[model samples]
Every structure is written in structure tokens, then in C-alpha cells.
Target: MPLANLLTSLSALPESGSRDAYLRFLKSAGDAALRRSGGPEHVTGSCFVFSPEFDRVLLCFHRKGQFWVQFGGHIESEDASVAEAAQREAREESGISDLVLLSPGIMDLDRHDLHAGFSCSAHWDVGFAAATAPDVEVSVSDESEDVRWFPINEMPIQVPAGFGARLERVRHAAMSQSGTQIG
Candidate 1:
């Protein structure tokens, strides 16, 4: 799966805090952006999901991170698009199949240094946004220890500081995309 199109999709995003870093990854990855060997750097896809009411979001307690976080993971060979990969990961992790992306363009771009336990040295995470119906049922996946929805104001306090801040940006983006007022 060559990621030239994915690169194009990434390159089309509006200027963002992590846009430069994401563009650098796309430029450096060349045709290999979709086939990372899980070494130094890898391109990953993630989806940040919010309820249709826009008052809550879904999160999972990632076993590796031991904290509540949005659902996402590395891109796979069969994934046709970054959005597809993001939706698949979100559905798999959150057990919610009705998620709808807020936009076709990338919603958020992030670069993160991986902990020692993961195979990838670093994760160039491409984030998309999904809207879930309010009060949807959620189940914990094997990769996660817990799965639940939290009010926007009371997101669990154990997530990564960076994740929390980035989530706010995602929330605002999602809100604006759907013609809703942000916060």
C-alpha cells in the first residue's frame, strides 16, 4: 500500500501545530509511508470520536499507556484510506460501528515519541474525527482495559497531558466542522 495519496491527503491539511512534522514524515517516507517496519518512525492512524450531541467523547484505557485515550493504531496493508484505518481502529476498540467522520480532510496531525515497549521508535499519528450517537453502548476490547464515555468537561484525568491538549483542539475542530459552537 503506497501512501502517496495518504501523503497528499496529509499535505492538504490546513496549517496546524503538528502539520510541519506530519509533512516531514510524508516527505521522508516517500512511497514507504504505509509500510513502516516499526523501527525508528512509523505512520499511524487515529480517530478522535465525539458524540453527535457534541457533549461527550469515547475513550479507552489503553493497556500499554494505562490511561483513557482516544481509539487508533498503526495503518495496515488492507486499509484503503487513513480515514478508513481510523474508523476501523475506532470501531474495533470502541465496539461502535456507526461512527461518522466529521470531515474527509485530516482533522488533526500528531507526532509522538513511543515508549520503550512498543515496536515503533516513534509514531507519526494522523488523526481523524468521528461522530457517535449519544448513549451508544461500548465494550472494552482486548487492547484496552476499559471503555466508556465521559462528559467533555470531566474527561478522565489520567490521559497523557499531550493527549488532553490535543483532544481539545480536536473537539473544537469537530464542533466547527459540524456547524456547532465550540465550548
Candidate 2:
């Protein structure tokens, strides 16, 4: 089947009521365009990042696929807000006990190519804040291979699509709240 058609079909499926639902949502959404590419549904995920300093963010290196992504996921139920879920998922996955969910609203949705024959939908990412030193130990979870902090200007190349811009917006919001200038 064409990738886009496959993704549409996958998205139309009933939610699996598992962690996999978020993954499915991402795979379907990201690959919606791939129906034209003649591919299949791929894995879905949620990702987030933490700003530990004024100009740095924490990121995870996913073991499963070895890609760098923010902390987020698929919508689990109709009850919880996507942002709430994103924060909870990030805390669980990254073991960052001191993080705070920074909010006005969800920042953005992003889509990207996935493995095998599938594409993914917008990863519903929610950004957060932390005040720990840059080298704080990150207790890795099964979902991630490794975790580390990166300076804003020195982020990894594979940092999820749209993340840089979103982080910039988040920083601006924070700066505004603090009555400071961001340049």
C-alpha cells in the first residue's frame, strides 16, 4: 500500500489502550504524507526536553532507534491533557525529579520520517524547566539509551524537527516572565 494510505488506515484504527497508542498516533500522523510515498506505519513516540540553564536543554538518545527527540507521546485517553501527559511521560522516562512544566499552551506539533516503510505524525511535545547544574546525573529509562544536556547553540543535529524554534519560543516566554531580554 502507499505510505499515506497505510498511515490513514493505521490512524483510523481504534486506540490500543496501551503505551503503543501514542506511538501509533505519531507513526500515523508523521507518515500521513507517506501514503504517497508507498510506505507503512512505523513506531510512534512522545518526547520532551528540559532547560537546566538559561541557554541549555537536556535531550535523550533513544536506544531503540538511536535518534535524538524531545519528550512527548500520543494522547492516551480523552481525560488527560496532552501537555499533562507529556510532562508525566518525560518525568517517567528521564528520571528528572526536579522538573517543572512550563506552560501557556502546547508549543507545537512536529512530523518526521521513521524507520522501515513508515512515517510519523506530529510528536506532541511539551517543554519544561529545571534548575539543576548542567551535568546532573540522568537516570535513563528503558525507552532511552542515554541522556545529556546540550547548550542551545550546540544541540545535536538530529534534535527533533521544529524543536529549536519551539525552544526559542519557550525561552522567550520565560524571559518575558522574568522581565528579562532574550537575544
Q: Write the per-residue lDDT of candidate 2 for residues 38-135, one digit (tens) a residue.
A: 23432222434545345776777776557776654443433144445556666766787765565424333344545542244222232433334566
Clashes of each: 0, 24
Per-residue error (Å), model 2, residue 180: 4.4
Give the TM-score of each candidate: 0.91, 0.59
Instruction: Give the 10-residue window scoring lowest on summed lDDT in candidate 2.
Output: 34-43
Per lDDT, the best of the predicted structures is 1
Off by over 4 Å in 1: 36-38
lDDT of each: 0.80, 0.53
Residue 1 CA error for candidate 1 (Å)? 6.4
**TM-score of predicted model 2?**
0.59
Q: Write the per-residue lDDT of candidate 1 for residues 21-61, one digit (tens) a residue.
A: 77776777765665566356877789888888778888899
